[model samples]
Target: MLSSRHLIFMEVARLLSFTKASQTLFISQSAISKHIKSLEYFYKTGLFERHGNHISLTKTGQALYDKLLEASQLQESLHQEIQQLNETFRPPTKLAIGASTTISLYVLPSVLSAYLRQYPNLQINVLNRNSNNIQNALLAHEIDVGIVEGLTQVNTLTYTPFMTDDVLAVCSGKSPLRGRALVVADLPTIPVALRENGSGTLAVIDDELDKRGIPVASLPVLIRLGGTEALKNFVLADTCLAFLPKRAILKELAAGELVEVPIQDLTLQRTFYFIQRKGTESNQLVNTFIQFTKRHYSNRE
Candidate 1:
């Protein structure tokens, strides 16, 4: 358990504003000031130096803040572990997972269903967003785990390679691009449907094209869709080509509603990541689910 003064100091250090920290911690501003003063007096050092309306941590304060953060994390982890131990027979574990639109729509449902069958007591909640938003959520401590495409360079997060997926160029059967091998240069002339910003599929497509000295700005985008289903629907109804995850359009391809076209000089393969914050312990349920997903995909491959 953290002392109230220490917790208040931690919140103020993180927010950098006594008023904001007060509102966040549901304490009065005066109380926040008293706590800060107490901490500063005990250490005989100025924690925060005031400059107009802004406050910044001093060197000593920064060191203390780092120590406080580590202590708070350890306290939380200990509490969670004890709770897990208390409910030995049927532990109630809640996991909040963030995923990109493509993985959430096409890949996660069956995997989650199978996981639930094995651990029926675990409660799972999924938040579907774009890759960037998923990363943001993980950083903000809003989600326990994230599954995203492409590589992320957030130093605080640890990424494990979960699986690889291919993005295929697809169009309606009636479209002219169907039944043809299209080259990279040809993509600029065709009206393409694209996913919105922050989407993993869109990011990979843009990155791959850039590597080949082709700018995404060169492509004439006919439409921008928010979700995978919307993008597939746009391609199915219009004469526009879309780059989509192969898993997303499997049923459409099988039913002849959409046709896959090979793109020359492009192999849009992306590795999906299982991401979690570094130093965070994985609960038994999370560990089991991750293992199951790995085994299931490995057997399929």
Candidate 2:
């Protein structure tokens, strides 16, 4: 178990705000300050440098935080193991997972249902957010795991490949591009319905287009939808063309509501990753679920 001072230090380091830490811990600001002061005095070094409203970690603080993170993980792992042994039936564990919109709708439900059947005592909470928000949730220790696509450069997070999905260029059957093989340059002439700015799908599409020297701004975008389902509905009703995850609109395509047109110069393959903070040890339930996901997806791949 971590000391109260150490826990406070960790929270402060993670959030970089005394007020935010206080709100998260349900403690007063002065109490947070006192805990930090005690921790700094014990270590005989300063942990944070405050400038106006902003605070940054010092070098010594960074080193201490890394060590404390390892220690906390070990302690939690030992506690969980002991709890598991003590409960003959099964120890209850809570696992909070964050996921982007497309994955939450199309992918995670089946996996989570299978996991729950095996580990009946485990309580799983899934938070659906955009890719960037999911990353932020993982950093804040608000979720045990995260699944996202694109923008994978997180030093503190460990990513393992879970699945690969392709983004398809699709339009209503009535659209002019419905049966035509379109090129990347042809995107600018089509009336496009795009996903919102922070969406992983949109980010990947923008990045791929940028690589081909085509700017996203040049596209004739009709409307920006918040989720894949919304975008699919927009395309189904309107003449707007959309770049959507292939898996997300499989039913629509099969039913002939939408037509998938291959893009010549665009390779819009996106990989989903299972993400967790580096140096943290997962509880037994989390470990089991992760193993189950790997086995299930591996066989499919």
lDDT against the true structure, per candidate, is: 0.84, 0.84
**Winning model by TM-score:** 2
The digit string of per-residue lDDT tens for model 1 on 99-205 reads 98877887788888888888787788799998888998888666778889875469998888888888999889999887889899898899999999888888898
Model 2 poorest 10 in a row by lDDT: 279-288
Per-residue lDDT value at 231 in model 1: 89
Which clashing pairs does model 2 show? none
Error of 2 at 139 (Å): 0.8
Instruction: Give the total clashing residue pairs for model 2.
Output: 0
Kindly report the root-mean-square deviation of model 2 from the true structure over all alpha carbons: 5.1
For 1-301, candidate 2 gives per-residue lDDT tens digits of 6788998888889889999999978999999999999988988999999999989999999888889977866765776778777866454466789999877987788888887887788788798998889999988777888889978578888887788889988889888777798788787888899999888899899999999988788999889988888889999998878999998988988999999888896889998888888866355555666789878766655
After TM-score superposition, what is the CA distance of residue 204 in candidate 2 from its true location, in Å? 1.2
Q: Which 10 consecutive positions of candidate 1 have the poorest summed lDDT?
A: 87-96
